[model samples]
Target chain A: MSAVLTKDIVKTFADVNAVDGISLAVPDGEFMVLLGPSGCGKTTFLRIICGLERQTTGDILIGGTVVNDIPPRARGVAMMFQSYGLYPHYKIRDNIAFPLRTQRVARAEIENKVEWASNLLGIGHLLDRRPRQLSGGERQRVALARALVREPTVLLLDEPLSNLDAKLRASARNEIKQFQQRVGTTTIYVTHDQVEAMGMGDRIAVIDHGRVRQVGTPTAIYDDPADRFVATFVGTPPMNLVAWNGGHLGFRPENFLPRELIDDSAVTEFSFRVDRSEYLGSERIVYGVLEGLESVQEITAKLPPAHVDQESIRPGEWHAFAVRNSALCYFDKDGKRAIRH
Target chain B: MPRPLAAAIREVSFYSAVLFFVVIAAFPFYWMVITAFKTNSDLYTLTNIPFWFNEAPTLAHIKYLFTQTLFARWLLNSLIIGVCVVAITLVTALPAGYSLARMTGRSGETLGIGIFMTYLVPPTLLFLPLSRVISMLGLQDSMWSLVLVYPTFTIPFCTWLLMGFFKAVPREIEEAAVVDGCSILGAFIKMVLPVSVPAILTVVIFTFTLTLQEFVYALTFISSSAQKTITLGVATDLVRGDIYFWGELMAGALIAAIPVAIAYNLFLDRFIAGITGGAVK
Candidate 1:
């Protein structure tokens, strides 16, 4: 069953259409991520689902019930914020128990749940400490614990890991996924980081300009993007987009191979001048300007260290390269993916 | 070495300037305390004696002020009015300020600004017409008149003060509460209020002090000996027929300033936190 659903949700702020009539469904126990650039209404859509924000005109159903006019508290949902939003004055135990206490659960039950949550998050020893005393990662765990302790039907996380440093973000992301899986709760995660969406989500909804560009499993979205935006947005160093004749050809840098590896009679082959190369430990990223293109089209190719001699390939030297047929993505004039004929 | 000496001289000059300003600000209060304990003869002599307590200090003025005049009654009246005004101001201001802070859209912002602007309208201009309104309610020459009138200034000022404070609280914290099954009111009470204790305490102190020291309204509205507040009673009785009781008047002034001074000294951190927190953000 669809645990949470929105149909044609529209939200406008003054002259700006912040959420412009978007629709989607989050199935039971699914980790759905709304991935987009900042201000693309991903967070707005999450807020609408959590009932923190009111949609201008839409139907929001949680667990198959229309909840448009329902207040957030009655919606049976909990949100973990990007800032953690742990009550600075409350100890970790009270913070986790807040929702249960508000619901008038028995005191023993509240204590048991708080303990369970703290243990789950590896914060059992820190329950007596206030949020101010905890480090950023600890506070984040406490926030997650607070939300999970409620055991709501759905959990909404709004860029919850964005505040952490780079190294912490990576480990924290895995921990968040692990926690969500163990809880088996329907989760809607919002982030602009495509890597996070790819790593954390069961299904990724790529959004831009207040609209959903595509929604599919992370693998499908990455391998067969619905549009040029999703294609470039999902990859490391982004997909290399080069205008070819009347259409645009997209391919990942890792897919490009040296000419010696490809058959001479290959169907797609291009000659380019090597402009620059960056050595990223295990692989060399060679940036080249395509020879026969009208625009200054630069294509980057990731070459394994074994295949090419770094000393031989100097800048301003022309080279021939070929892309694997399965790796090439073609986009028509409107920037939409053209179905392969 | 020579450069260090010049720097030392500059530092000494800076400290001297600060000391001069501190003495200027504090000298009047110091003199008030000393004069309060002085005999009538010592006050009349007006000597520039710095440290020595030459003559035996008398508590006659303090005794006379307390017993011979309606000073105690006026003090009680002021205390009653101040406390009531503070309580009323806080009750009205907190919720209203929270609403202004959390509610989105242009209307909420406009309304918040509108309420604050009402505070800026000069009280001196409004009090004359407000006096007529007070008399119509038959609160003239009564402590109740001062109680009712003081809130007109206190509520708006405090609401504005607290609106800034409430705005400083992160919206995410409130949202987290809401999602945790808290109604808007619950979120306010459980989350916003606790974090905002310092700001609220500062507001209480400010309102209490303002209402306690208010002169124009208290002087204008109340006329009876029993009904007059501290400021009115002291000014009227001590300066009878242009023969000022400087010694006794200073004594009364010193006594009256004690409560607020004590309150401030106790909660200095909260006051600084509220003003700086509210102002900067």
Candidate 2:
């Protein structure tokens, strides 16, 4: 019942449109991630839904009620800020109990709910300490505990993992995903990191320039991007777009492989001259320029360490590379996806 | 000089500079204490080494101050005025400061500077005009006039200070509170105020001390002996036109000054932090 729906949400600051006409729906218990580069209006859109920022013209509905006029607290939503924003003077128990206390929840019930939320987040032992005393990861969990204590209909998180170091980020990501699944509250997470979106989101909405380019599962966003922007933005070393046929031919780095390795009968061939290669512990990314194209377009091939031996690919040498016909994506002159014949 | 000797000379000069300033600062208190306890004859004698008691120290002047003068009354008057002014400053400045800090764009900064400009106006120049207002209110000889006047300066300065302190507090904290179900004012009270203890403490101390030390308006507004504040009473009551009661005056000053001195020392670091406002952590 706690689904969130927004209709044509737009927020303008002065002459600039920070969020331009974003309409989205989050079904109950779904983990939706708004993914974009920095300054891409993803965060602004999330804030609009949370009621922290009012959209210039839009209707926001939470649980079938149009909540455009409702304030954040009345809308039954909780947001975790980028900085965690834990009250420095309050003990961890009091921090978790704050939202409940504001609503005049009875003292005994407040204590019970605080204990439940803290224990759920595995932070029961740290409840007596203040926020300044905790580590970054511990503080993040405390923020999560405080947000969850209210049992709000929708949970909004704004780049909560961006503050954590890389080693802790993966584990924290797992904990959050598992916690959401267990709790089953509709969640909207905003992040600029595509890897996080791919690993964690039930669905990812790729946005740019205050507009949503596409919204789909991570696989759909990755393998079947709707346009050139989504194709280039979602992957690392991004989807390689080479000039072809008055438009561009796009394929993922992993899909563009040595002709010897791609065993598929229907595949497109290229004379890829190796410019350089990077040996990443698990895979080697080979950077090269393709021959027979009028313009020298740079592209990369991701080779698994087991499949490609070291010293086999060297600079100044040419190799035959192929992409499976199905994996090849065609874009018209306007950069929109065109049907492949 | 040899390397070790050169280092020794540098250390000696540094300690000497520190000791020189300490003595310069401590000498006034030393003179005040000795004069307060010294016998009048011993204090006045030209032949006796004035640094120490030439005669036995006695409580005669201290007794005279208590019995012959309204020293205790003046202390009580100061306390009442200090408390009242501090309360008014807090009630007015805390909200004024919070609003100015939260206000967006160039206008808040401009308005804050406008408010602070009032604090820079000299009290000596202000007291003349203020006395006219005092007489119009029929508060000519009442200490309540001081309670009303001290905040004219205290509120402006304290508001400017508190504004800076509140601005340094992360906006996310208040925003988080609003999302957690508190109204904006509720967020300020529960979240903003608790974390702002050092700045609030700074404001309290600054307002209290300023009220304690103020003399101009206190002297202008109150003419009767019974209504006089400590600063005005101590400076005027212990002096006869041609002769000065150095012992009684120093005793009054010593008693009045000790608390303020101790307070400054106690909260000096936090006071500096509050004034800077950006270095809350």
Identify the candidate with maximal DockQ: 1
Candidate 2 residues lying further than 4 Å off, grouped into runs, are A292-297, B1-3, B279-281
Kindly provide the TM-score of model 2 when superposed on the true structure, using C-alpha atoms.
0.96
Residue-level lDDT tens digits of model 2 in A222-264: 9999999999999988888888888888999999898999888
For model 1, state the Cα shift of residue A172 in Å: 0.8
Question: Cα deviation in Å at residue A334, candidate 2?
Answer: 3.6
Chain A structural similarity (TM-score) per candidate? 0.96, 0.97
The CA lDDT of each predicted structure is: 0.87, 0.91
Against the true structure, whose lDDT is highest?
2
* Weakest ten-residue segment in model 1 chain A by summed lDDT: A289-298
Interface RMSD of 2: 0.7
Which digits, one per residue and each the tens of the lDDT, describe model 1 over residues B164-206? 8998998888888888888888888989999999899999999
Q: Candidate 1: where are CA atoms >4 Å away?
A: A263-267, A294-297, B46-52, B104-114
Q: Which digits, one per residue and each the tens of the lDDT, describe model 1 over residues A210-254?
A: 899999999999889988899888887678777865778888878
